[model samples]
Target: MKDTVMGTLSQRLEENQIQLNQLLGKSTDLVTKELQLDSSTHIALVYIDGLVDTQVLHNSILYSLQEGAIQDQFKDLDPFQKLELLRKRILIAGDLSVTHDFKQFVHQLMSGNVMVLVDGTADALRIGLPGWEDRNVSEPNSQSVVRGPMEGFTENMRTNTALIRRKIKDSQLWLETFQIGKVTQTSVSIMYLTHIASPDLVQEVKSRLGKIDTDSILESGYIEEFIQDKAATPFPTIYNSDRPDTIAAGILEGKVAILVDGTPFVLLVPTFFVSFFQSSEDYYQRSDISTLLRFIRFLSFFITLFAPSFYVAVTTYHQEMIPTSLVISLAAQRESVPFPAFVEALLMELTYEILREAGVRIPKNVGQAISIVGTLVIGQAAVSAGLISSAMVIIVSITAISSFVIPESGMAVAARIIRFALIGLAGFMGLYGILFGVFLIILHLASLRSFGMPYMSPIAPYRSSDLKDSIFRFPWPLLKTRPSNNKIQDLKRQDTSKREGSAYDREK
Candidate 1:
């Protein structure tokens, strides 16, 4: 007992119990029950209180061992033989493993597994009895859809994986598990299609995950930030979703998904910039309608990013670009405002952002009402008080509304941050500065990579094959091949012989 916890088990049972208590600090929840097999052998059960199922412990392990018939069978065997018999015949649990390492024993015990140690054996049996509380599967709040699966991922990793497994039942679907975080020992899992995903990309993902040596990983964001390609850029290289169908779709597209234990959001790797604009409902609805909606989203992205900056530039520098009547109206509106165009735009944008954040942070019952009424009242008051022009208010409102059109919040936030920088540049150098900013932004996007895949794939490098599903999605019948930009091993998604001719051609 004095040497180390890793030492071989002593023939005396009391010494083992004493060493376990010393290592565990004799916590109140650490239950250790001692039992005797006739007059020769002894055994102990060690487990945490709330983590284990008491009903199973009583009816499965304790009741079976306390029976006279079971004790009679144990009396004829040695300690090692008795332990083997207990594991093979006695335990009613589905999963059980034998471990000799002291560190692994403690780890299993803390993870809600019951440990059974014999009087004279070095190895111990770990019984699975996890009974922790968790939320039930429900609809996703962030990425809701009009026509698709309503079921979303819960905090449980097994449940999340099962959700995906239920959707895609292919034999080639592979799942690999890892234990990260030295202190928390969080369970992480990566899943991909064996036939579709690149083996090199899988190896690179495993290599990066192995390099993480932090003390804790509370959320998937921690892993995302640690393993992403560019840490300096505002653009997100990794895509995250709480919908199982979305994750399953990514797997089918030759992408890998990382599922963390304690969070519902799963991270998808090798994501392209176009993915943020796509939604789960896109594939469910008609391709023509989905394509039109996608085009609107793309238009809204630019409007959200450049609306205020364009206004500032046109008013302060390029007045000739505006029509005579519209210019007269804009000039008349701003005549009452004391501040310059840039200052007025900045002030309105900041105020709207504050109100949006306040609405989110407040209680849900009154939050929406307050945000709506607050915006209307504040806008009217500012215009009447001559604090900001009515035209500037309208511009900020349109810009704010356009931001909600983007499917992903991360990309929308990047647009919000870049908008201010564009506004500043426009204030000094006008339209030329705005053009320069757009060039630099595109340059940065072209330079970024996610797990060796181009961030602006099928656009910057210009892949004609991938354009079928880029800005506008083609019909499902026409999309017979996978994206070539991902460099996947499999190129053909379906057989072209199954494809039929269009209705017009058939009629002719």
Candidate 2:
């Protein structure tokens, strides 16, 4: 615990703030250690530097002190009234503050505000100082869907929430705040629909969040693992996103969203396995186009999952299934490599992984000129250098690109990890091993549940109505009923019978 100071600056910093920073390993530069006192006013302007808007802060705090607004507000009213009115109207653009105590004042300043104090004043008035000190919103590099809203979430939590809020525009949308980490004390918000969302699910999510015991929460992934239901599965239970429309859609569908400060990724719980294939673009466009795109995504998904394994199986055990020409070409390509086909594939994969890591680790911001876009040349060079076979390079490149095509990056990573397992299985017993491995993966997915709803819903539980929206989307008019499992109250999507009858009469 930080030592609580009664009424002194030197005393407070020496006891509370320094100890707290040391405990937390916080940046000393962010902590504003300042002291100023006039004849009737002594003040401590403790704030996180760079986060405050200097112009607004100087206008509010220093200008108020010079103008004597603090003393003037206190002249007619009681001590409490002065603090309240000044903070309500004169200082804060709104009434976000409930108290004018030292602790509350400091907290507000840390969150971006200017604090004003007088020597004789009992409490401090926090001036509204919202700073625009963050990177501009940019296109999401990870979950880039071609036909959806181009806006993406940023590291700033408030900006991220605002982007989603713009999409929702409903009063029933609720945001509950909490601080998770002991030292970091990072801000986290849980967003959900109050009326439409399941009460049990909301409470369950809150219960899990409250149970977390951690010193710092730096990313949504940290909260994801802590709150997730355990069954020793490698696949992620939480759906992580960098798009606000996707999160807003999730909130509308009765899922709880967790947004942590300082990371673009947000976590949505009770996410179905089908959601990994679904994109924000799926809902924004015409139903026919949506259906076609959805089907293509599904094909890409299965291709990513089974392509390498199928290739291995056909080359090794199921050689009869391959065309004679392909076999001759692949055989000719592999003849130079002393290693087996499987070994060659493994070597290429490892080499690609190293190059991918190198690309990320070499920070472009720090003047590193290395670009991964020349990957084709690198692969060609590798083959020419006799480090890998041409067939292996092609296979590795295709697999990597296929994995990228999966909309949900978490699932893409899951596919990558599972692909390796499938490769191992294929190398062992070819077709049989590959089948056994895929079967296990399917079984695991079927058994997994998100907030008591099976991960593979509509397929595992078999709901025909929900299937219209899942796997492959059907025509919007044909989807006359809401997804049954979603349990939406406004279920009648369209009057399909009336439309069909009118169309028949017109034709006649």
Candidate 3:
């Protein structure tokens, strides 16, 4: 079959019977496929709402056709050479691209590339002019901070890739594209520094991606679970972020990043235990402030994971763990509540989770109002009604607030779920339960390997040099070497030891 250009996709779609419509995902973005077949012929066009540049398609192909389009002379060119020539000389007709595979052609079309099909042609002409309106780069909503690069990943993959390219201008930086998802045909980009990345890890990731047998992949989360090292683990084996700077940093550190179309968040593989405790701001701020913040985040993470368990163990089985005055206060508070410690904690946790879930699912403008009202109504109203003690309210509130301190929201969420199991254990065996839970968690973390690198990384292997970047912020100059745990062969990042935390801080 031959590829043809038409003024209108409707021209190829005889009878003007081309069909188009949006997709069924919960997201409001537009996606559609149009099929124009009459009696015996068949052709289709697909495009994502904002992703396809229809004007470009019209101007390039339609204008060329109306003006008696001239086809490039690639008579001696092979298919590959012909494709390249079309891209270079012919289809420079604006943003039009040409493709061969029917499935891939449809995929491109859905992604906002216009498709042109002529009668009796086996191949389709796929045009590239993605014009999807994306939000301008801004600070990540979940990872907002006063310091750090304000640029965030946009939903558009091209824009997201550009952001990283701007950060690391090395020619070794590589971006490999693959169309994942059997039906959804989502575009995923695997990026890494060619010289620094481990070949084994790259192969492993590619193999895992090739094995993903899913009909749809809406976001990086879908790709994460499908390619996760383990199926049933509370810990997140893959790291994800909405910040371009974060992904760029990961890439520089010999880590690989996965960028999926249709989502702003990208995936970082072989993430170490220390990464979850880190914030993008840590690298942007003064080392003293960064270290302090890191310490606080670590402390807050423990509070999120152990606070309720600590409370339950002390109040229920180990009253001796509580001070005498505190014990009396707890007793007084519980006297008015009709539930046992386990029941009370469970009820409050479930309530908080429900409130949080509802808050997020609600409309954007109303989400904050719902959260405020829900918290006030649940905590204050329950306290006034003597249904829950004010002390328990405070404990739950503290736990929720602490959870937010974790820079990685996905890991924080996993920790929150596991906290309940820890609480149950604590209620049964007092401090022993907490210790047992922590022991298991630590063991699991130590045993876990992400693309052959230990999940605990510098801690598990115990590299003193790499420790400079873990759990504490060392001066940028001091971190002259890459983390040995990343398994990057050329591990030296820089040799300049003449550096303080910041120029401003030093001047002060």
Candidate 4:
């Protein structure tokens, strides 16, 4: 069986069918139709049902092969000549390739291409006729924006690549594709700007992908887990988004994008800690508004991370930090509660987390309603029952709302998980523990790298040029250089001297 797999195809069509059958087993969806071109010549059309376009197979291969004097002309020519005639004259396929190895042909067949096998020929023709139903490009539920392109990536890899290509039309915008999964044979593509992206970075990305030895790649998340720099860390080293504009912007900044087949999410490599806070909409809006929104996202990040812990630390150990009136109010609120400040905050946070998860897992039509109503009812009931304090509920609610302010869900999730640990620390060792946890988090982030680039870049390492777009996005004309963190080949993004209105224009 191993020798046969490595060997080239045979001139006998029946034996080829046996080899394919042995390899593919008795799959009910695998369609094999034999065509008698003439009295002497026979050919087989093999493809997976529901994958290939049946209409095209009927009109192009079936009708064209059986219709005219085309069959009569095949009698005089040899098998090789006959196959050439079918390819050059008969088939109306836009893309087709000829292959001798059975393994290659089978891969193409499973990929929705129709395989043509001739009786006296050693090679087969694989015709491109992929046609399967997929969701139309719709607004990305994950990364929706008030202003920007509404068309998100579909599950179809080609459609996703085309969407990015539509934005960046330069020849330097190149894409390379390879199959990763052994059993699934999923097609994964890496896209980058040829002239702007560093050669070393592109090679490193390809090397990591090529090193992935897995049997199945079901989605982009599978690849993300496999190729990420640090698996143990809660923070996502690689960024993923369904928005093409976001992906295009990343590629423009010399980052590589990994697009997996059958998934809408595309992974961007060398993603900095600050990248998660930034959104594609930031570029669409004015610089000042974008800067203000970015500051809010950063502020929300800190609030989500430290709000509950801060409240816990102060209420549990350092009551002097709060005003006399506020402290008296908090004491009154907690007078009926049996649990300590730590337990009360923990219960409320856990309840909110459960409700938030339920909102995600449940049906979309009622998920939001369920989460909102469930939280309110549960919180009010818990307060009435004296199980949790009102102050704890307010803190949990503020933390939950702040988590949503983050643009990237991956980062938001990381912050949410870390918030629990910080809350636990605050419960045990007061403000000191929360401070220690934060210090350790910063150290961990500083040590982490995303494909050789620092996870916390431009800020920790202090690249003045790249800082223009890190925490605060500078004006469009002022952002004249690409991000220096990627070690990009091309440093200058735009020639500011060509601007219609600027200091450069005034000098001109």
Q: Pick the candidate with the highest TM-score.
A: 4
Model 4, residue 298: displacement in angstroms?
0.9
- What's every prediction's RMSD, in angstroms? 2.5, 4.6, 6.8, 1.7
TM-score of each: 0.95, 0.83, 0.82, 0.97
- Give lDDT for model 3: 0.75
Candidate 1 — which pairs collide?
Answer: none
Model 4: CA > 4 A from native: 1-4, 500-508
Q: What is the clash tally of candidate 2? A: 2
lDDT of each: 0.88, 0.71, 0.75, 0.90
lDDT tens readout by residue for model 1, 19-83? 77888785999998888856766889999999888788887789878887777777778878888
**Taking the tens digit of each residue's C-alpha lDDT, what string does model 3 give over 105-224?**
545656667665543344456666767677888878877778878778888898999999999999999999998876778889899998998878788889989998878888888998
Best by lDDT: 4
lDDT of 4 by residue, 1-508 (tens): 2345667898999999998888777899999999887887889999999998999889867988888688678878999888888888888774877999877887888899999999999999989999999899999989989999999999999999999999999999889999998889999999999999999999999999999998999999999998888888999999999999999999999999999999999999989999999999999999999999999999999999999999999999999999999999999999999998888878887888888889989899988766656776798899999888888777877788888899999999999899889999999999999989989998999999999888889988889888889899987877878999999999898887567787745653
Quality of model 1 by C-alpha lDDT: 0.88
> Which runs in model 1 stand beyond 4 Å of their true positions?
1-15, 365-373, 500-508
Per-residue alpha-carbon lDDT of candidate 2 for residues 167-248, written as tens digits (9 for 90 to 100): 9899999999998886577899999988767777888888988999888899888888888886488777789899999898
Number of clashes found in candidate 1: 0
